[model samples]
Target: MKVLSMILAGFVVGYAVSDIRPFDSLLSSTAEFGSPTTIVNGLTVLALTACLVSVALARSSARGVLVVAIGAVLVVVFRTVGMVTGMFGDWAGAVGAGALLGASAVLAGRHRAAQASLAVAAIGAGLLGTALDALLQADDGPVFVWDVAGAEDAVVPERAIVMVIAALGTALSLYQAHRDVALQSHETRRTLLVGLPLPIAAGVVSWFAGGHDSGDAVWLGALAGMAVLAVVAAFALPGRDGRVLLVLFASATIGSMGFAVEDSLQLAVSVALLVVGAGIGYRWPQLYVGLGGLLVVAGASLIEGYVALPSLSQFALPFVVAYALVSVLSTAPGSLAVALPALFTMSLPVTVFAASYQAGLSLSSDNAVATRTSEPDHLVLSLAGLVVVAVVTVACAVLMRRPTQNPAAR
Candidate 1:
């Protein structure tokens, strides 16, 4: 029952965070300054910041629940009035929804050991939500056609359904929090301040790269900058948390390469593979194996770019990404400070890929086609990011293996 509640909480938060419909609606209804890509970038930063603040401030389980509940309420309000209020309400609601997600994870997994499972569940649920949203928005029959421009208008019934899920999840999480012994939040202001800027800056860089004026040089520079920052941040942080961040960076990079999946069935299959990989990682939790999987994903992507393989082979990408992420998280000391920031950082790569590849806006094809061929430049860019991630993953692994110095011995 406890696990179920956590899953529910994760699903709600995941759905709220991943669903781009509200933002899409906001952009369409009002004259937003930037393109869809820029808005997404800003929203990602806001969500990351909100997650950090909510987790840092929620000193107890009760506070965590309260924060999450408030976040849920804000999302519900956004869904209700987003069309009416234009941009500000939608943006504010997204931030609140992000806070709810961050707080709920902390509340559910109060101990270090449980944080990995909570993260896995939450991520899987979020991916599921993304797939479901696509299916729900399909214009003809059950088949969902991918549109890079943006999803069709906000589906009213779907919005209501998501709100209900968020409410129920919040209630369940509250009940579970009340039953369990309250765990004090371990996050500190110093750590929050130190860790906050990297992901936000990464998002900003990605947003800039995604802009119409930016070219391949800007995108490559952003990728290189993010890689350096992630590696430096990983080593700068003490113990396993840094390694966790590196692995998540790799996961995000690999996962973002899947932008070519054009239909709902392929997406559902990819998400299913993600769940399987998460389960495997939870059971084994091997860092090296996960690292190797990252390499395999990189290799496979390069191969697919040049060689014509069976289209179904693409599903392996998400599996490897999820496995790598969960494996590293399982080994780390569960801290929302690390987990939430790392998770948000994961979004930067996706933003970059979307902007660089001109996803949604450029990729328009017949619904009957299951997948589209990725451009050569996009493949090369993905390979470059993945190679950097692999290098960082190895460096992190080596650093993690080193013995800590004993003060008395020194």
Candidate 2:
């Protein structure tokens, strides 16, 4: 149930934040911004930020329900704006109704009254959004008659169902994190540091700065910058658990790969980055050493220009290896917590790739699929380079797990 709640929360958050709805056009048109799109985007940002801030405050030493309340208010305002400006149509009403249902669920949960109240507020916000959407598009306008025309037979709407699942998963994950998982002092700090901004900041910067030119220097420059950052982080924190650094590097690399793929680069930078990240994971046995090598590979790529790249297939190998390492070395909660943002970023390209594959199959066309690999040989070489990360993580986990006979160490 907790897992289901978490998954639902994730899905709700995703849907709320992204303008993926079919009716987004209407909402975008209604906002104070020239278009409804800007309104929706602004609202999403505000809501997401509020939620994240609230979560951060709750997790840290801050004592107050203010952050959570602020989050709830922001969500309500977001919805109210959408509805008042004709963005929601009849959807606004559904949001109210859904809030009632969600509130009931929250009260039933095991959390303290305050926590449960916050949970209820979140659910209310989600419900209100859902209801507002539903009301906006009702077949027979405003008559209160149940309209089944466009409705699915499923109890929960498809998108809502997905959000619920994600919320459940997230809740379960938090529960697990609160259980027995232990981390070394350094590892804990490293994990927290890496999790803070790398996931979102790198992504936003890359998205806005990316170029359309096939061999644009910006692409290579970003990769090089990432490499440098990794090296710096690794060296600055050269503890035995350098594997945490690799995990952080991998998350950043994954973000870049997603950006490159989403941009539809003919250069196949995604493959290269993935392979390089993987190789660091599998060999070297220390993040610092792996980072040094990564910097070299990226620097070489930047210097080599676009023409001398190798095959694309080599790129997938590193991701497979990196994920394997993540699955094996990290405890369940740590792995899930660390993986969420990375996987979320990775999903964008995976979705695009899957869609392209499906389209290719549907047309029964013989047109060769666009190559994601920059070059075959480079991919292979990079994949080999990824082994360092695996070695480092495994070795660290093993050493960390061993009993210390030395009283000083203990």
Candidate 3:
């Protein structure tokens, strides 16, 4: 019976191979068409579908199902590396990576070792992807940095990948939490902690790695991904997911918004997004994210006011009002602790950097009508903002501090 099954498998494999080979001929014959890649891609998709079907149907007949799937992958990679490189930009590599990811996820489902290993790999992938981008795209040195100032197009694709990874991990993280499986709240927290320092570290490394226009795809990806997480965390997910998402979200928020937005109006638009996000986060248990959204408003308002509004008093006054607004709207009992640090982290770096950057640019000599110097005033505002941050952090720490109560006291 085994010999008969083997003979049948050989015949099936031979037929499949002969049938799938026509793609190359079809591709070559139609080279004069709209896009060779589109044709090849269509063929590849069809081939992939057939291969998947074979894998499914052949499982009961033969043990070579996985080999069939792998062979299909190799064919796609060969086509991609040779033809799709120029058209789709290394699409084969991405498809291959995705295959590996799916495989890892599957392995994780069945085995304990694979589950832990895949978790580590996922966390590392998220972090290393940023670092690799920083190292590779850093063109700021002798190589010469090249990019349109404030370009979002290059960033969009990277953001897509980052978000996919984040979304996948987030989904899996939630599932693991749900399963009472190997991964739990602590693992989720650990993954977030791994995520937090990465962007900052990538920023520094990119500077040294000859990062062009302030780190390439990775930094941008991180920023874009975190913004997405902040919204999703605030609005979409609940409970534990929300908390960890907040931590990861806040990690990327600082020093990001000013660079992410082009000007005051753009910043305002982002603030609006954050406001909607705040509403989402507000209804959730942890008021920290909502407070974080308020912090977003405060920071963006500060930047916008300083740039668009003439008098420092105009922006500063509104900024004060924003602070009051945050205080009034913050609804959680223990939220103040989270709120204070988020405010400090989000506000100080962004304010100081934006202020300094504005000061560096050549001011209009035509502005005799204005009394105070924009550069000096902005620098002062930066200084004052830092001081306020310092005072608030210290005061909050002192105020929130409580002596440990003995068990007997209860």
> Could you say which candidate leads in TM-score?
1
Each model's lDDT comes to: 0.56, 0.34, 0.30
User: Across residues 270-355, which tens digit of lDDT does each residue of candidate 3 receive?
Assistant: 33443343333333323333334434434544575458753333223222322222222321111111111121122211211121
Clashes of each: 4, 61, 3
1 versus 2: better lDDT goes to? 1
Candidate 2 structure quality by residue, lDDT tens digits, 1-410: 43333334433443443322321333445543223243233322332333233223322221122223223323433343342224353244223222322221222222222222223223223323444345434564333324223322432243343343434454444344333322121123433444444444444433322322213244445544544444443333323223444454453343223222222232244434443543444443343444444444444433334466553323442343343332222221221233232322211111111112324555566444542312223343233234433443455454455442211111
The list of candidate 1 runs beyond 4 A from truth reads 21-42, 61-67, 70-85, 110-114, 125-130, 139-155, 259-267, 330-376, 402-410
Model 2 alpha-carbon drift over 4 Å, by segment? 1-55, 58-157, 164-209, 213-216, 230-245, 248-410
Candidate 2 lDDT trough over 10 residues, lowest sum? 346-355
Give the root-mean-square deviation of each candidate in angstroms. Answer: 7.4, 14.1, 21.0
The ten-residue window of minimal lDDT in model 3 covers 331-340
lDDT string, candidate 1, 246-349, tens digits: 87776666656343345676766766787788778778888788888777766777777778886433577667766777676632222344444355444443
Q: Model 2, residue 231: displacement in angstroms?
A: 5.0
Q: Where does candidate 3 stray beyond 4 Å?
A: 1-84, 110-113, 123-410
For model 2 the local lDDT of residue 148 reads 27
